[model samples]
Target: MTTLYSLYFSLVHAFVGLWLTQIINRRPRLLGTWIAVFCTNVGLILSTAVYEQTGSKSAGVAAVAMVWVYNGAFFLSCSSIFFTAYANPVAMRSIGWKLYRFYTAILVVTGILIYFVIVETRGYTLQKIGELFDGKRVHLWVKSPVDDKESDGPDDGEIRA
Candidate 1:
């Protein structure tokens, strides 16, 4: 059963790569390439490692959970770095590879620390979990509903006389 689940995830991961490649071909960008490479390569490496290290059914379940967590973190990290690098091409050009390596190291270290430090949030509310991260910042850019009013018609909830 675990093997079947693993096989399914592996196939999905492969398809995601193919889809990303097609998208990248249409709109090439350094950040996209970096995300594709890291997500595919590191995901394969770490998931395989987890599978190899775990043999029992409980261990296999834990391995599957680890794979899911790792993938989620991998996607988010890639996204954050992509936006940062995309916004600063000059800095990306000068220190992109260095930043990539540094971020990768930081991710690994942080994951290890989190594995040790994080408490299970199974029963916690979203707000409670968010508070663990210090809550939201007011200064962060968020598109207002007013901005969407321009595109949305009167019947679509736009206030109109």
Candidate 2:
């Protein structure tokens, strides 16, 4: 599953990636930026869905796919952001240094959150969020009880008084 998803997305990712890069490069629009942001989210979702379905398969492959999808997508948006900033650094200056500082702070905070959301959770299960690609929830090693126990008896002795 990992190999299949990776192979499929990698091909699709290139076309999308190039489209975004050109959009920011040749024809820049606010709408395009918004679309790029949405595309980033879409990319994250695709990679995540694949991970969830195939988490039990291979940890390393899952990690690679997540990184590939996320970093590639985020790079598109960040590159566009930086390009816009480069094009109009004067606009940033107009807001004053304090606002610029605030802007930078927000970027850092949001970047961290985005990384956690997209990348960190990719190689994990619904329960073991910290670890990557474990079959069970985290390292709990919860062994399912044998079926014989249920069929053994409802109760060994039951006295009704």
In lDDT terms, which candidate is top? Answer: 1
Query: How well does candidate 1 score on lDDT at residue 110?
Result: 57
lDDT of each residue in 1-161, candidate 1, tens digit only: 97566446555655565566445441233334434444643544454445556544654565456546544434432332245426546654676324445546655565555545545454445445556567552222334586553343333322334
Q: What lDDT does the true structure give each of the candidates?
A: 0.47, 0.45
Model 1 Cα shift for residue 72 (angstroms): 7.2
List candidate 1 segments past 4 Å from native: 1-73, 76-88, 124-161
lDDT of 2: 0.45
Error of 2 at 31 (Å): 27
Instruction: List all candidate RMSDs to the true structure.
Output: 16.0, 20.7
- TM-score (all chains, Cα) for each model: 0.28, 0.22
Kindly report which residue pairs in candidate 1 clash with one another: none
Q: Tens digit of lDDT per residue, candidate 2, span 1-161?
A: 97576556555655565676554442232234334444444444454445556664554355445456444554444432344436435754565223333434555566555544433343334454434444343332333376433232223221123
Candidate number with greatest TM-score: 1
